[model samples]
Target: MSSYLYRLGRSSAAHPWRVISAWILLVATAAALASSFGAPMRDDWDVPGARAQQGIDLLREHGVGGFASARVVVHDREGDPLPSAEIGTLTERLRGLEHVADVGPARLSGDRDTAVLTVQYAEPITHPDLMGNIEPLGGAISGTVDSGLQVELGGEVPDTAGEAFGGTGELVGVGIALLILVIALGSAVGAGLPIAAAVAGLAAGSSGIALLAATMTVSTSAPMVASMVGLGVGIDYALLLVTRHVEHLRLGHDAVESAGRAVATSGRSVVFAAVTVLVSLMGLRLAGLSTYDSFGLATAIAVVFVAAAALTLVPALCRLGGRKLLPRAVRRNRPLRTREPLTARWAARVGRKPLVWALVSLGALLVLAAPVLDLRTWPGDASSQPAGNTTRQAYDLVAAELGPGANGPLTVVVPTSATGAADEAVATLRADDRIAGLEPVVTTPDGALSIITAEPAFRPTDERTPDLIDDLRAALPASAEVTGWTPFFSDISDMLQERLWLVIAFVVGVSVLLLALMFRSVLVPLKAAAMNLLSITAAYGVLVAVFQWGWAAELIGVDQPMPISSWMPILQFAILFGLSMDYEVFLLSRIREDYLRTGDPRGSVVRGLSATGRVITSAAAIMVVVFLGFATEGDVVVKQLGLGMAVAIVLDATLVRMVLVPATMSLLGHWNWWLPGWLDRLLPTVRVEVEDEPAPERELVGV
Candidate 1:
């Protein structure tokens, strides 16, 4: 396997022009297509939901213009006319304003105390600025005249999360990215390459993703995701490859040879690591979840581009760097040596204190994982939302004064063996205090299907409100199987339950399966899995404590502790798991290769650590750079994801790779290589070789 890679390395060098040109063409074309077809990324990036469609339908049915069609809801002290005599006088005064088709004679809602105002408008709500009209909707009622009451505004616009939910992501994303990069890289130059690569890759890759999305029916988030991961890994892989090449030049190899050397060793490692990430991400297909499927597929595409860039552009640049970058002392040239003492030192330690190291690392990881025990999940509702989205604001207004259930419609469906059966179910649900407004449509007349439009006064992500979903399900008639935004959410609840195991199995099983093949050992995979699990658990705990439980919240600038979003764990697991595989593959491949060549378990572990550990650190550093970029995106979720990933990468690189892997291997001794002989025979061997001369300008150093 090494020889094959060695040959590939030689060939790429021998035909650098061809390999290089192909890459240029690919990227250039990709850039063009991407830009020409690119679309601005939008969040909630999901398709228009049934509720949105229903609302649109209702507007059309009523032929409601933006003015007269608008509905203003006011809730105060449970028994307030809302705009009292003083308030109503103010409301009446504004009734004569232009664009006011009609201000209905205000009346209380079904609850009998809160009032609903019908504001007739001349236009449909467009830009947020137009929402200024909401201030006047308060008409005669709000301000000092209605000082005793808490008057919250809810009209056509606020019902959509209002104008305030705008640009939250943009502001947050930028701030977080800047802070992360400055801290992680330390030096300006160190930060530049990764950021440059990430920016360029994202710019080009997003365009490609857009074109693909147009043709492929992709989810809205695909483009942003593709851009994010593409920039991250592209810069990361390039970082390691270039850094290795530079080090070789520093050692006194010719530029071409140094480039070849870097390409063969570090570049090959990247291919393997990236492929591992791709494979792990591909597990999404088995998750039986479309969201995961989209995420996995888009991520895989980005990985492919990253791999290509590392192998091609990075090497081309390395070759170009040559004598210009190599120090005079390094370029002077000397006899080459392959022996590495650093490996020997690690080997000695493993043989000496493996048990202590392993326990300490494992224990530390467990402490981090502790936060998972109290993990809280939140839905994608207004308050818990990243903030500034119209839906988020509108939902917040409804929930703040109304009650917890305000954002979604509740649908009641009965197993109607006959017609009108649905009507009875609808009526039964209507009588329930939990539901308020009723709008039935599109179902067969057998009353088998009826719809109730009820909003949760609390945010969707709130624990208390989701409980209502459970209550509605449990309390509703046995004949009814509810399905609406609330239930479609609840509706998929069971399905997701069934698939969570599949997701876990796919991630764990594939990881183990790959390790078994790479090391030809059952024990290696088991140990690797254990180590990875510990690391992942620890990272999750940290996130939960910092973000969810808000431990040391002030340090992170979180104003308050909020429950973890419901989808956060899933997204976090997918990303972290895939990234964990990145470091895992890099380290294991090196160790296994060394073991196969030297057949010295202890020495192999040490040697592997020595040869690859530095590079692993470099790779992790680049990944941190990538993650830090996202933190700057200014959105809370982006910040969490970025920081979470950055922390996890730093952990895997230093603590897990540098310390624990070696220590554990020392304790395991030959058990690290233990495998059924027959099964071992089935494992495929992979090899990488460096051929051709080291770049004329570079030389091996400290060998």
Candidate 2:
């Protein structure tokens, strides 16, 4: 592997302009393709084989393409239901809008302070232009506002549009990463090279995803997430190569040899880390969710581009800069280290007190992870919207006037042999305490399917809603099934829970095998997996504390505590596991290198820590900063992802990497590198560290 990378880097350095030109051409072509054929991404949350999915299929078979309905809520501050005259005017205008199939009669709240008009679309609210189609509805309503009258739109359509922060988080993340790189490398040119590579890689990635959207059901959030992951990892990958190349240059190696050696060593780590990430993300397919699959695949593509560019583009750029990578003054007055690096010093201290540090770090992580026991996974609803946003205001108004459950009503379809079950269902439903009200039953033309709408007594976000669903299923005929927004989301959550264990097992199994192959150690992979999971669990606890427990929810732009997104845990684990493996590969691979050289476990730990600690921490810091920037986004789900990832990276980098890793390695002694002869023979030899080969002897006759 090292020889291959050395040859590849040598070629790239030998023809630096060709590598740079090829990257430019690829980026330009991708951008052009994206601009020409790219379409907006859609979120697909439907769970295959779920009960709700069956109901939806039935509805689609019935030629009922327009199952998505919304509410245009008008609040009259004059203490009267939206004037019947005004309701007629708004309803007439809404009926005339494109994609709008029907506008139901206005229903006034019992308090006569608000009126809601139900608007049905001609198809499921999945179109990219849904917001464009609905903008006129809001605009029309706003014009009617007078004398304390307010208008807002809510329901499936508006929710599908979500909120756009216009990539602000990505920009802030890049800026902070640039500062960190500058500080670490101590040269603007040195730092800028990685940032530039990251930008180019992200641009190419976005273009590729945009093109993929033509055939695949990519989520709207995929680009945002891909950019977030790409920027951080891209910078880190390039930073590693550039840092190593500079070290080689300082050791008196020429530009080409330095680039070759750097890529041979550090570049291998980047590829291993990237492969781990891709493997982890691919585990999302085990959950059987299109949205998760889309995000996972999209992010995997971005990481591929960044990782490839780090090996090819970054080395080319490093060769181009040559001695310019360092400031002139520093290069001329380079000083040798007289004292051990701080990382080595700290490692020595922890090595002597391995048990104490290990216990303290493990105990802290476990404590932080305890809150995950109470974690709830549900699709966040209108309640998670910004406080003053129209959707949130409308939700608050309905919950205040009509009841929380009125915000989302369940639609039940039952195949009846006669009117007997239907009549019994109405009576039984009314008598049930959880059923707030029953809409008139509408039977199919063939009388084969009877549709009954039941309004629950609690909101979709309510814990009791799941109970209500269970109770209704129990009371209804065996042929009857309940489905709607609430039930649909609940079904997704249930599906995720069922597959969670399988996905975890698959991810862990595959990850362990990969680590074992890379490190050639059974115990090393096991320890890495355990540490990765510990950090991830700690992150989940943070999500529960902040989003579920409403701890400083407002500070992050959430109006109230909400259930974690159904896809969050699955997505989080996949991404975080992969990211955690990155640090694992960086740290452990370095330690393995040192161990092989010194054959002293204690000394190797200190030496390895000193060599790679600053780089790893800087890399982790870049990732954490990028993730935290996303946490400030207006979309609650994305916000949760950002917060959760940020917390996980922090825990993994500081507690797990800085403390637990060194302590554990110290405690394990030489056993850390042990692989049984039988297993070692069975596994393929994958080497990430290569000893520096002596420069070929040159003939002195010419001189």
Candidate 3:
């Protein structure tokens, strides 16, 4: 592997412009074909399961060409049981509108604060853009509604449209990320590199996923997740290598020599980091669930792409640009600034109280992580019009005025039994204490099953809803089955919990083993695994505080609290575990390099931390912008993903990398580098990191 890398560097060095121009062309081609080559990453885009498929199938069959239609519940602030005269008037007006084939037999429930209206579209349900009918409905209803009524359209149509709306957010987020890079790196070239790296790296990641998506149903969250993870790490890797190259060139080394040194150092670190992150992410597959499996594959592929680009494309770019990369004054005074410093002042603090700093930093992370223990996994209510819109106001006013379950129903598909067993199963569910209003599903004589709609008093993940499913599952006779929105949600939750440990174990265990083999010390991998886990927990805690607890939704632009994304835990594990290691590997590899050369454990950490810390932070600050940018997104899936990762990166860089690591090393002393005598004797000490200045630059023959 080392030989292969060496050869690559040599080849890239010889035909530097070719390598550079190749990457440029590749990136251009990728951007041009991005949408076509890498399809949008959406959940419902191709949801599986017999239930979801059946719904789509039924919608298509019914000639709803657009999709199976859903009812929009426009709320009336005046109350659910608005005067009968008004209900009749409003219903007639909406029913008469174009594309609205049928106005639901809407009813004001006994509570008198909410109503359900069924809408049927005239176009074929599969008409690609099914929501074409819905937009007009919202516009017509919003304007035509009596002031007292607040409108909400439930069912799949609005949810799908809401998700589509997030595509706009993706573009907005990209621009914001670019702006942030300029602020952090202080050069448009520097700022642009990360975004460019991300664009290229993630394009490759998505292309890889297209292969996976073709074969298996990836978790809906995979693309959203891999995009951020790949972008952050890709940029971090590029920033480290590029900045180091720039620093080298400033010292009088030609672009080729500087590029070589930067790669020899930062390239090594980026590879280590990428490998570590890959191990961490693959651990999620240990959970043995599809959602996590999707996460593991999506992120692992991205790590490899980013790491490759960092070493190959970045160096090539530096060499291609030549003297143009350096500032004019630096070109004149290059030799003075380029000389390597033996060690910074802070690196000399190796003998300080490592334990004190370690504990202090660790404790701070624990505090930030504390709130996650209280985390509520509420599925955020899906709404249209900023949360305050009449639709939202009506939703809140009605939900508050009536009760929580006043929202629309969860759709469940059951076997159509002429013997009435299917109906009995539903009746059994309606009789359960957990459910509110249950509706029968009408099926064609052809035997296509339909969904029974029901409103559950508790949240989707609420125990009552799952318990009700259990009761119905028990009540079913031979040849009968029941599954819909709530049951499927329950199954997914149960699957996640059951598989979470496997993922954690696999991710941690595999990463540690790999780290151990690479570094030849058990402590190296163990500390990394522990520190990464700590970072993740702290991030989740932050997620709970903000998105879950609704602490500062306005600051982040979230209009309301939402239930956690169904796939968030796995997404969190896949992205956070992978990324935490990106920084961990960056910092650790530098320390390892120092330790190997100086044979001083304490001295190694100090110099290593000091050297890598600033770069890590610079990389993180750029990532924070990308992440926080998406926090403004309307999609709950994107928001949770963005905030969760952003929070994790911040905590990892500040607490885990900067403070906690130093303190722990201070306390452990030589123990940090300990290896058993017999094992040490058997093992050939491989220099994974070197403390010495890069050996006097070595030149290679012509290509």
Candidate 4:
């Protein structure tokens, strides 16, 4: 693999324009195709085999499936009764709009100053263009606002019309990344090389996702998630290769030769890191949700393209810039060193007191992880949206006037064949004190199914709501099933919780095996797995504190404490675990390389840290900043994911890499590289830090 990559890099560098042109053409073609034929991405929360979905499908087949409904809440600016004439006109306009099936008579509140009009859609909320229906509905209500009425649209239509992607968050991330790169590389041209490669790769990957959406149900969040991962990994990968190339240049190697050496050595690590991420993402399929599948596939595609760009485009750009890739001082042949680097000194100090450093870092991580014990998860709803959002406004209004459960009503579907059971279920629901209100039963014209709608006294996010669902399911007849948006989301949360361990097992098992194979060591892979888990759990703990516990929720625009999104644990595990392995592979490969060459366990640990610390820190900073930018996004789910990733990267790079890793390796000594004789023979040699010539000796000094 190294040999082939070396040749590929050399050829690409020798003919830089040709390589650059080829990449440009490929990206252009992909973008053109995507724009011409790709489908719009949307979230699909359906769990295929869940009972809620089964009930929904049965109702749809019987021509009695519930239609998507929206509320048009109006309030007179002056505390006076809403004019009947304006209400009549608004209803007529709503009825004439596209996808409008029915507009119910206006129901006035006790004060008569507030009125609620329900509009039902012809199709289900899962319709691909559900947001399209929302626009016209909003237009229909616009005229009423001018006539002294304050109107807000809410319910299924407006609640599902998610925020637009690619806003302030992305721009801020890119800007910060560029600044970090420039400072780290010491040359603007060199810094731009990584940025250019990353952007090109992101463009190609996004187009691929768009094309993928045409063939499958892609989640609306898929592209945003893909972008966040793609940009971070893309820049980090290119930075690794570019940093290696710069080092080769400093050693007096020519452009093409330097590019070849960089690709052969650092590019191998990039491939390994990307493979781990891809493998982890594939584990999302075990989640048994289409949303998870889209997330995995979209992110994997981005990673592949970004890694490819690093191996090819980065080298070409480095070659084209040549000596300019170096800083002005270095290019003028000035002395590059004055004293031992700080990392070398720090590494030596940690090596001397390995036990103390290890225990301290471990204790800190455990403290951060303590919050996971109280972690609560639910699928986000209108209540989780920003307070200023229309859906949230409507949610607050309905809860105030009607009931909190009005925001998420439950629908019970009963087969008409079980007439006695249907009657008994209604009686039981009416008897339950927890029930807020039960609508009259409506049966299909064909008399095949009976639809019973009931509102709960509590909000959907309330823990008791799901408990109520469980109680109903147990008490109701087998023929009666509860199905609605609220129940659907609850079922999804339940399903994800059940399958979380399976996904973690698959991802961890496969990753550990891969790491073991790559390093030809048992303890190293096991250690890496344990360290990665510590960081992941710590991230989850932070999420619980900020989002669930509402410690600093206002900073991120969250108005109230809400359960962590159910899918986040599995999603974050797969993504953060894979990403954490990135720094692990890079750091461990260099350490292993030095250990193999010198046969000095302690010296190798210090030398590896001295050699790779700057690049690792720079790469981690870029990832952290990029993710933090996305943390400011409007969508609560996106914000949580972004913040979680940023926190994980920070902890992984600082405490885990700087303290725990060196401490553990120092304590283990020669055992860090220990492989059983039989196991060593069975594992194929995979060189990540290939050397064509002898490595230079380092001046190891104590702090």
Candidate 5:
């Protein structure tokens, strides 16, 4: 693999124009097509094969919008009855919209101060343009409102708000990355190479996502998430190779030869790191959610492009710039290797007291991970919405006028055969203290099915809400099923929780095997896996504290603490594990190379730390900034993802990578590279830091 990459790098460097032109053409074409044909992004959380889905299908068959409808809340804020004339006009206007099929009769509160209008669309509410089709309706109604009354849209339509990423995050992330690169590389050309490669890779990846959306259901957050991952890894991946290439140039190697050597060594590490990340992301398919599938696949595609750019484009840039890549003053007086750096000294100290350092790091991780015991998962609730958002205001108004339970009422579907059971179920449901109200039962024309609305006293994010659903399910007849956003969220939460272990096992098992093959070691891969898990667990605990426990929620730019998104832990585990493994591969591979060259294990550890510590730290810093930028996004789910990833990467880079890894490897000593003869024979050799050279530069044909 290393040799192949070396040859590809040599070819690309030899024909820089062809490489640059091909990449430009590919990205430009993709961007053009994406702008014209890109599929609209939507978040459809409907779980296939669940009772909620069945109810949705049944609802659609009955000429209703099923589970998809917008609720228009009309209220009098001045303690006067709402204008019935205006309310009637508003309903008619909604009913006249292009996509609106039916508007339910306005149901006024006892005081006639609040009125609720349910606008059902003819098409599936999941249609991307549903909001656009009815946006004018909101404008028309708002124009009719006087100082005495307020009209607002809520439920599904309002829920779709804040989907736009606004490019602020990407710009901030890239800006921070560029700053870091400039500091580390000390040359504008050297720094710009990685930034250019990252931008190209992200552009291609985003175009691919837009195209993929045309045929599949994709989360609106997919593009931002993919960019977040792509830019971080793309820059870091190129940075490692660029750093190595500059070193070779300083050693007096020509442009082509230096680029080739860099690609052969650090480029191989990039490939292995990217593969590890892909493997972890692929595990998301086991999650059985469309959202997971889109996120996983989109990110995987982005990583592939970035990895390719790192291997081919970065080396080409190296050849193009040559010695000019370095600052002239620095080039004239290149720093020479004299004494060991602080990182080397730190490694030696850790090596001398491996047991103590390992215990301390592990203990700290365990303390941070302790909060996972209380982790709870649910879809974001009204409280999680941004401050001053109409959705949040509507949610508050409706809850205050009606009840908190009215925010997400559970829909109970009963088969006609169980009419008698339905009566008993209704009695049981009304008897429960959690039940706030029960709407009159509505049945199908032939009485084949019945729908009962049961409003819970607690909000959807409340823990008791899910418990109530489970309790109601058990108390109701077998033919009766619970459905609605509240119940559907519960179902999704349960499904993700069930599959979490399976996905973790698959990712960890395969990652360990892959690492073993690459390093020809058992303990090393196992140690890496364990450390990755520790870092992720610590991140999970922090998520629980910040989002779940509501600690410093305002500081995170949220209104309050909310239940962690049901799929967040699983997604974070997969992504963080792969990313954590990235640094592991880069660090361990360099350590292995030095170890092979010198029989002294301790000396090799010190040398490896000294050689790659700055680059690794810089890379992790870029990743941290990218993740944190997304963490501050307006959307709750996106914010959770950003925070979880950012926290995990910080811990992995500092605590796990800097402290635990060296400690464990130092303790393992020569045993770190041990591979049984049988296993060694079965595993193909894959070196991340190959020492072998290719044929002489003159003999290479492409040049």
Candidate 6:
């Protein structure tokens, strides 16, 4: 594998333009194909076999409330009753709009200051043209807004548009990454190479995601998530290869040979790291939701393209830049570092008291992870959106004028043949004090099915809302099934909670197996898994504090405390666990390389830290910056993912990698490299770093 990569790198370096042109053509072709053939991306939260889905199926079968609906809220700015003439005109306009089946009569608030016009669509929200109605719907409401009334659209139809993926976050993240690289690499050309490679790869990956949407259901947020992962990993992967190549050039190796050697070593680790990420993402399939599948597939595609670019384009660019890739001081053949690096000194100091360092770091991680014990999760609703969002404004108006429960009305579907059951269920619903209101039973014209709407006294995010769902299900007859957007989200949260453990086990187990094969060590993989879990749990705790506990919520634009998104833990575990392993692989592979040559465990630890510490921290800083930039996104789910990942990366790079890993490995001594002879014979040999190659002399610039 190493030999193949070495030859490939040398060939790419020998013909830089050829390699460069091939990448350009690939990216352009993907973009063109995506533009011509891509399907529109949308969110589909269906849980196929869940009760909520079953009820929806029943409703759709009967041609009733299964379709999408939205609320056009009109509020008088001066707290007076709205003009009836304008309200009636807006209602007629909305009914005439495309896809709008009916506009129900306007319901006034107690104060008569706010009115809600319920617009029901003929098709479901996922229909391609359903979103098309948004523009016309806006046009229909313009005259009302032109009057002295505040108008906003909310509910399933308007919420489907979600938050747009503005390029501000990506541009800011990339700009910051380039700045960090310039300072670390100390050469304009050197700094730009990785950014260029990352951007090219990200373009290809994003185009591929669009193309994927043509063939399968892709989430609206998939592109943004892919961009986030692709940019961070792509730059980090290229940076690793560039740092190694610069070290070789400083050691007097020619550019072509240096590039080959860098690919043969650091490139090997890149491949392994990327594979670990892909493998971890595969666990999302166990989540049994299409949204989860799209997240995993989208991210995996990005990683694959980014890794390929790192293996190919970075080396070619390195060769093209030649000595210009080096800092002016280094190109002048000045002396490199004359003293031990601070990382090496720190490693030694920790090695002197491994037990103490390990215990302290472990304790800190545990404290950070403590909040996860109180973590609660729910699928996000419009209420969780940014306050300025129209949906949020409508939600607030509805909750203030009507009850919070009015925002999440539950649908109960019963067969007309079970008239006795329907009557009893309606009675039960009306009797429950938790039920704020119950609508008259509406039966099909042919009397095949009956539909009942029940409003709760609490919002969807409120704990009692789900409890009411449970209580209603228990109280209603077996023939009556409860379902709606609110119930569907509740079911999704329930399903994710049930499968999260399985996802964790699958990701961790597979990663450990892969690491054991690569390093031929049992304890090493175990220790890495444990450390990764600590960092990930710490991230979860931080999420709970900020998002759920409302600690500094305004800092991230969260308006109030809400349960963490149910999908966050499983998704974060898969992505963060793999990303955490990236630093682990870079550090350990170098340590293993040194240990093979010198057989001095403690000294190898110090030497490995000295060799890879700066590059790892720099890579992590770029990742942290990139992720935190996305934390500013309008979507709360994206914000949670971004902030959680950034925090995890910081903790992993510093507390876990710099402290806990070294301390544990130092204390374990020879056991850190030990593999049972029987197990070693059974496992296939995999090398993350080339063993026979000579280590390059250390250089002062970044390496």
For every model shown, the clashing-pair count is 80, 0, 35, 1, 0, 0
Query: Which residue pairs of candidate 2 clash?
Result: none
Error of 1 at 433 (Å): 8.0
What ordering of candidates by TM-score runs from best to worst? 6, 4, 2, 5, 3, 1
Ranking by lDDT: 6, 4, 2, 5, 3, 1
Q: What is the lDDT, from 0 to 100, of the residue 243 in candidate 6?
A: 96
Top candidate on lDDT is: 6
Q: What 10-residue stretch in candidate 2 is worst by lDDT?
A: 694-703
**Winner by TM-score between candidate 5 and candidate 3:** 5
Q: Which ranges of candidate 1 are over 4 A from the true structure?
A: 1-24, 35-204, 327-351, 386-396, 407-409, 413-450, 453-459, 464-467, 492-494, 554-557, 596-598, 632-634, 688-703
Q: Give candidate 6 misplaced runs (Cα > 4 Å).
A: 694-703
TM-score of each candidate?
0.74, 0.96, 0.79, 0.96, 0.95, 0.97
Off by over 4 Å in 2: 36-39, 63-66, 131-133, 146-148, 327-329, 334-337, 692-703
Every model: Cα RMSD to truth: 7.1, 3.1, 5.8, 2.6, 3.4, 1.9
What lDDT would candidate 3 get against the real structure? Answer: 0.65
List pairs with backbone clashes in candidate 4.
42-220
Reference-based lDDT, residue 617, model 1: 66
Off by over 4 Å in 5: 32-38, 42-44, 65-67, 131-134, 146-148, 334-339, 692-703
Tell me how far the alpha carbon of residue 670 in candidate 4 is from the true structure, in angstroms, after superposition: 1.3
Q: How accurate is candidate 6 locally (lDDT)?
A: 0.89
Candidate 2, residues 578-609: lDDT per residue as tens digits? 99999899888888888887899999888888
Candidate 1 C-alpha lDDT tens digits along 47-81? 13322234333333444421223444455665655
lDDT by residue for model 6 (1-703), tens: 9999999888889899999999999999998999999777877756795779999988778777688888999999899888888889999999998888889999899999899999988888878887534787789998888876899889888887667656687579778889999888888899999989988898899888998998899987777778888899999999999999988898778889999999989998999999999998899999999988998999999999999999999999999999988987777767666688889999999999999999999999999999999988888778898889889999999999999999999999889887598899889999999889998888876688888998888888887777788888898999999999888888888888889999999999999998998888999999999999999999999999999889999988888998998879898999999999889999999999999889999999999998999899889999999999999889898899999999999999999988998899899998899998999889998877567767555544533
lDDT of 3 by residue, 311-368 (tens): 8877776666665555444435433344333333443442476666676777888998
Q: Candidate 5 has which clashing residue pairs, if any?
A: none
